[model samples]
Target: MSATGVQQVVAEMLQPYLDQEGFELVDVEYVKEGGNRYLRVYVDKEGGIDIDECGRISEYLSDRLDDKDPIPDAYILEVSSPGAERPLKKPEDFRRAVGKDVYITTYEPIGGKKEFEGRLLSYDENELTLNSGKKTDVIPTDKVAGARLAIIF
Candidate 1:
């Protein structure tokens, strides 16, 4: 099956388990690294997730994958937290990130640049405001290609 298909299937299979366990599904990736393929699921919660938690989730999903047999080829299966700089994909993620430092990339230039890194001032449905030092940039929601929490030095 296709990479996106594999990811979507795995995500759907894992959601119920994650929700029951109070874990948030952050992202799912099916990628090739060198000669091997990997299926990685990133999960998180209010405080943080630990090695034991990851191991448990991995074991649970491994069983489900074994039964469903979604992927056509052999691949490594991994489950873990998204870490300190978790990606902001959905609108809810952006809403929760307000007042936090963030890095964003747009599909097209906003304020003559495609990248913006600053404190996320606000995010309404239409646009998001970012304050970078003395300047603030307001970018339309549709323009964002990717966004993530930033660990400022």
Candidate 2:
């Protein structure tokens, strides 16, 4: 299967277990580096995820993936926390980051620039308002190439 397909399948497979354990699925990535392929799963919770919990979750997911055999090639599987700079992929992620600092990059320049780093004031379906203290920028959601939690302001 394709990398995207592997990610989707793994997400679906782990959804029930994650929901039951109060763990949030942060993101899944299937990629190749050098000559080795990797399947990485990033997970978190309300109070943050611990190393032991990550091990348990990894073991559980490892078993599930072994059973399913969804991937065509051999690869390493890793499950862990998203760390301090968590990615903002889902709508809920964006909404939760409304009052936090963020680093957002647009596919193209929005206002003669492509990068915006500041406090997120608000987020809606169409756009998000960010205040850099110097100025406030309203960035369209569709233009975002990448978004992540930035250092607290």
Candidate 3:
């Protein structure tokens, strides 16, 4: 099975368990590093998640994967928190991140720059407003290539 196909199967299998546990499914990655293939699930919830929560999720998913037997090759499974710099993958993520500091990269240059790191003042369906120092930049969401929470010192 393809990577995305595997991810879809895993997500579908795990959704019920995650919902019952009050956890939000953040992202899933099926990738390779060195000679090892890995399937990683990023999960989160209000007030953040702890190691025990991750362990439980991991164990449950492990059992489900064993039963489903989706992937034919040997793969490592990992479940963990997305951490402080978690990615903003969905519109809801962007909405919840309003008034927070963030780092964003554009697929194409906006104002001759491809990167913006600042306080996220607002987000609409089409654009985002960011305050970088004294300047506020209005960036179209379509131009965003990547976005994540930023730790401001």
> After best superposition, candidate 3 residue 42: deviation in angstroms?
0.6
By summed lDDT, the worst window of 10 consecutive residues in model 1 runs over: 74-83
Provide the lDDT at 75 for model 2: 96
Give the per-residue lDDT digits (tens) of candidate 3, residues 6-124.
Answer: 99999999999999999999999999899999999999999999999999999999999999899998999999999999999899999999999999999998888999999999999
Model 1 sits at a Cα RMSD from the real structure of 0.9
Show where candidate 1 strays beyond 4 Å.
none
C-alpha lDDT of residue 19 in model 3: 96
lDDT per model, in order? 0.93, 0.95, 0.95
Query: Candidate 3's C-alpha lDDT?
Result: 0.95
| Clash pairs, model 3 backbone | none
TM-score of each: 0.97, 0.97, 0.97
